[model samples]
Target chain A: MRKYLLPFLFLFLFVFESIFVQYLPTEMFGSDRITVPRFLIISILFLTVFSSRKYGIIYGIIFGLLFDIVYTGVIGIYLFSFPIFAYLMSKLMRILQTNIVMVSLASLLLIVLLEIGVYEINVVINQTDLSFADFASLRLLPTVVLNSAFIIIASYPLKRHFEKFMASVSD
Target chain B: MPQFFLNKRLIILLVSIIVLVALIGFSLREREKVTWPEQFLKDMTGFVQNALSGPTNYIAGFIENVQDLQNTYSENQELKPRLDKLASLEAEVQRLKKDNAELRDIVGKEDALSQYEPIQATVIGRNPDRYHENLIINRGENDGIQADMAVITANGLIGKVKNAQSFTSTVQLLSSMDPTNRISAAIQAEDNKKVFGLIEGYDKDKKLLMMTKIPYDAEVKEGQNVISSGLGGVFPEGLIIGKVVEVENAEYGLTQTAYLETGADLYDINHVMVAKITSMSAEIQEELQSTLEEEEEEE
Candidate 1:
């Protein structure tokens, strides 16, 4: 049961992202800016940095597939993008310092990449007609700001938890 | 370059990219219904989502109730006059409904296009990705919901069921940018005249529905109520869609287009009713079937 905590955490974030985040009053933004909570991916990035990359990639693939199947019409967008970003983040972390600020910055970078990648794919598949300028202003900027705030609040606790879990698993 | 090709990680990356493209292409194709695997997954996720959102919805509703309390005095003052009118209007509607039914009985018309069974549903989850603009509802095929059934709130038409799983259905909002997302709508002109057109697309920036293909000379003015025409044979007739906001010439003056402001707030929706067209006579059903076949052949 204790071993399932990480996966449970991911699942909670996954469900919360789609369900509860919507209840956050959009009027708070005062403009029609799309703020998608990529908390699941942010936590997954934390797992990659603090725990094992192998487990992170596995969790990414599983949750990514779930996200695709449950939320979006098209499959493989999140399925492909999530694990790829997890892989890329792991590689980037190897070269950079593993401080909280550095990890948060890296997570934000991954979030931007994932957003742009998904946006480009949607454009290619003609799922959206939003121009790049509009996407940047309406979606990308707001999403980055929202997720960065999430990271700022969540990173310390998540990192400490993952480190403790990793130690226990190794032991 | 040679070493790059030799690397195992690069090979996995290239292979996965190919797989991704293939999966995307497969999912993008038009299908009559979602496959069983997709359906099963949706049901599983939807069950969890339903359970999770129930408490959250209650909390949100409580907050909304508190907000409503603050404006209760002003709202009551505004609605007291309307309450008297509503009583008379209800009586008039009942009288008219009886008269219309008697007339239809005399004419041997047992079925009407405006008939539908409303299936109550609660939104369990919305697509976090804003691009698709989809909602997952608690009701599904088990509740007699089918693809293309109009989903509406108390205000007006919101969208239609994109697909129905066993226990959950996906609603594609009218605001989604899909070329094939068209609805046959009619503008209620003065003197009970209706000018027909198709709601072709959504103007995202302006947040309005675009009703197009109106004849250039049609007298569609601003503020006219738009309702589903029932010519598409999917959505029931007289379901309020929106009110026209602006009109302009299109196709080099061959046709006109009108922008409509939807009554339903597409952003904040919790409950919806799937308008399941009910009790159509055999003749009308056959006519609809033949028209559908003819259109398919034309395509």
Candidate 2:
């Protein structure tokens, strides 16, 4: 029962987003930066922290695909990406345990790479033109800050929640 | 020796299986409708995100408020001299408003123009993976939103609705790199020249838009405007697409590529107009005209 509860938390969050939050555009202090569906990042982080690498891989794919359906982005953008991100985050978390700073940096790196990878795909697919100005400020820096901040705040809860859930599962 | 020979054959069989799998993957991609099941762990992602969103907003908002305060304080110090300039600017703005109203009155006669119907949506979800992936909108079938609906802000186009539910829909942004996003557009100022091109997104800081297939002879001076051609019926004509930023005459071909500086801040979208398309198709036109001509002849 508890096993279902942990993952259900994530499912509830996603469905809630589909129903309520998807409409509320992310307005930060009145500035609209490049706000993609942010829940993916938080979920990946949360699932990776709470569950094992295998579960992360499973949930990551599920989460990413749901995001693609929800957003209708490159239909497979998250579907293709989330499992990889989940698998990676899970592996990295296993070894890089106990340091918030390293975790923060990892989160920042993950955010930056996610943006960069998307841009790379866009260019390769000729979906849009490539501009240097956006590469610098609009696309990269803003998401980096946003993703990093999210990971920082959630890091504690993610760790605590996952730990409690894992312990409950074992018992 | 027989055992060694058998091991070699087994290794070769394994290699062949790997190669076959790879070849099938490559060939299958062109028609792959790969989708949702792969990424979505469960719907619960939203609840977790909802939990995380609070404090994240708080901290990010705090930083921005501080930044805005600094900017406002600095502006306050420079307010006196700018006050006179601002008065002149206000007068200029009023003059422009009158001119705009006059233009609007004239253009209002052209009822064929695309009418903007607006629906307000929250930016509840961002692209889960990448910054430019796409946006999920809460307004869906219940709001009368259908697939291919043009989503826009008070400023400009965001993208079109792809998949919709009773309560929500997914928007594929103009920034999405899908090749099918080719938009037919017209130059804002020239009015006579139309550019059939695709708006491809790029790796720029401000979500830059680039247009290809500007007639080699088109007068695409920098700062000239770009607007949709209303060709595909996805967007209305005359909505400000962007301003021409860079016009290129590369030696390889007799085509011009223009960079349009997009209008709306793609980062912050609130209320967007879903243009209800009301254009007559050529087939419909032909049928109606032929019937009218027959009626007149009988008379």
Candidate 3:
């Protein structure tokens, strides 16, 4: 049961991201629709940074596939993007320091990359029609800000869990 | 670690690419149907989502109510006059509806115009991806919801059912800028002659629905109500959509375009009604359109 904590946490974040995050009273933030916080993606990134890149990839594929099947019209986009981005972020973190601030900044940059990558892929597939300018101002900026705030808040706790998981694996 | 895992990363990359392509191909098939595995996942997650959303929504609503109280006094002052006017209007509208029904029966036409049955549904989830703007509602095929059924809130039309699973459905919002989800709409005229047009797209930056293809000579002005035209069998006639905020010439054509501040709360909708017209067949729709066109031509 203790071994299952990390996966259970990821699953809870996934459920929260899909259902409850939208209700956040962000009308005070702006006029446009508030991009709900991507807690699931952020947690996956934390897993990637603190644990093995391999764990990140495996879990990314599992949860990413679940996300695709549940929410999106297309299936492969999230499944492919999540793991690839997680792997890339883990590689970047190897060079950067692993403090909360550094991790938050890295997580922020990677999320921007991930959203833009997804947007570009969707544009190529003719699934989305948003222009790059609108995408940046409306979606990219808000998502970056909101998810960065989430990272700042959850960074310490998430890092602790990741270290515990890593310890358990080595043991 | 097995001896066969020498090129693990390379194999993983290859496997990911193959899986990605296969999933995309399968999803884009002719029917666009969900496989059993996907359906099972959706059902399970939908159940979980429903369970989680209930308490969160209640708490959120409570927080919102607390914040809204400050403004309620000012809003109440504004609504008092409107309430007095609305009571009179309500009685007059009810009388008119009965007379119209009697007239329809005398003309040997059934109540095709106002014969939609609405299924109430709770919105359980929304796509976190801001670009898609799809909503997941709890009522699905089990509640007689089908693809293309118009989903409306108390204020106005918001979206239409895009897909219907066994216990849940996905709604493609009116705010989405997708070209495929055009709504047939008309501006309300004093003389009751429809100024028909298509709500062709959306202005994402301004958060407005874009109405297009209006006749160059039609007198479509700001502050007029826009309603679904029932030109296509997709949405029923007389469903309130929005109010026109601007009128302009089309970018490259002879037609005009009107932008509407959609009446429904696209950002914060919790519940919706799916308009289901059971008797709306292609043949019936064609007949309805032909008669409507004949009436317009005579006028």
Candidate 4:
């Protein structure tokens, strides 16, 4: 039962991403910036840093596929990006010191990469016509701020949870 | 480091990238319906979304109610005068409806393009990614919803059903930048005339609907109402779409374009109605089908 906690947590975040994020008032941001919740991806990054990279990539693939099928009509965007980013993060973790600040910064970088990749694909497929400058200012900046804030607040708690869970599983 | 080209991980990455490209291309085609596996996954996610959103919406509604209380007095003061006018307006509408029905009876015509049945639905989830403005509703194929059905609110047209699963459906909002998302619309002109055009795209900067292909000589004013023309055969006629806010000529000077402010607020939506156009009669439908086939044969 305890071994299932991490997957259940990721499931909750996945569901909350589609269901509750829209309720946050756009008027608070004054309508210029669009703040997207990448909570699932952010937490998966933390899982890679604090727990096992293998488990993190596995969860990333599972939840990424779910995100693709449930939210977007396109399938391969998240399905490919999420696990790729997790693997990249795991490699970066080997070089950098493990701490809250580094984890948050690394998560922010991964998110920027993911957003730009998705945006470029959208441009090629003619799904959007937003200029590169406008995309950087309007969507990319605010999304980074929002996700970084989430990572800052959630870093310690998630770190502790994953450590405890890994202990119990290994036992 | 190991030889880069010979690494097993590199080979796996190359294979997956090829697979990803294939999947994206396959899904990008114009599909009539999703496969059963995709439908099953959508239903499963939609079920959980529905369950979770109910309580969240209740809590959000409570917060909104509290906020509304602060404006209640001023809102009531403004609405009091409108209340008196509403009664007379209601009477006028009733009289006009009766007259129109009598006229239709005299003409021996019972079927109208505006005839439709409304299916009420609750919004269960919205796509987190803001690029594609899509809403998942609690109603689906089980509720007689089909792809391309017009989804509207009491205010006016919002979007159309993109996909219908077993117990849930996805609605693509008008603001999405899909090139194929075109609607046949008409601008209400002077003396009860209508200037027909295609609502071809959306201007993201201005947050307005772009109506194009109007004749250069057509007179479209800033305040004119835009409604679906039903020429597209998907949306019902006379469904209010928006009000024109600006007009300009095309670059080639052969056609005009207008920007319209949508009647329904695309961002904040909770409940909607799917307009199911009622086919006239079996005999008429068969006759129409036969005529269409004959026209195709001539072509």
Candidate maximizing DockQ: 4
- Ranked candidates (lDDT, high to low): 1, 4, 3, 2
Give the alpha carbon lDDT tens digit for every residue of B1-299 in model 4: 55988899989999999999898898888899988988999999888888888998898789989999999999999999999999999999999999999999999988787889999999988889878888899999999999999999998999999999999999999988788899999999999999999999899998899999999999989999999998777788999999999999998999999999999988778889999989455666677789889999999
Best by lDDT: 1
CA lDDT of B289 in candidate 3?
90
Candidate 3 residue runs with Cα over 4 Å from true position: A25-29, A33-36, A96-101, A168-171, B1-15, B18-22, B25-32, B278-299
Off by over 4 Å in 1: A25-30, B1-4, B295-299
Kindly report the interface RMSD of candidate 4, rounded to 1 decimal.
Answer: 1.6
Q: Is candidate 2 or candidate 3 better by lDDT?
A: 3
> Candidate order by DockQ, highest to lowest?
4, 1, 3, 2
Reference-based lDDT, each prediction: 0.90, 0.62, 0.83, 0.89
Report the lDDT tens digits of candidate 4 across residue range A5-67. Answer: 777788888888876556874734458578889999998988888888998899889888888
Sliding window of 10 residues with minimal summed lDDT for model 2 chain A:
A19-28
Tens-digit lDDT track for model 2 on B1-299? 78876797477657655654453344225432224442242223433544555555566568768978878967888887888799899999999978877887888643334655667764445654443456655566678877777777878877877555555555767766665557777775466656566565542444468788767876768887778877555666777777888878745767877777777766555446676555545664577689889999999
- lDDT of candidate 3 at residue B203, scale 0 to 100: 81
Query: Judged by lDDT relative to the true structure, which candidate is superior, 1 or 4?
Result: 1
What lDDT is reached at residue A167 by model 3?
Answer: 89
Question: What's the lDDT for residue B277 in model 4?
Answer: 89
Name the better of 2 and 3 by DockQ: 3
Candidate 2 residue-wise lDDT at B117: 63
Top TM-score hit:
1
Question: Tens digits of per-residue lDDT for model 3 on A1-171?
Answer: 446798878877887876654665355356664575678888888889888889998999999899887777778998888888899888898899988789888888888888888888788877777788878887788788888878878999999989888988888
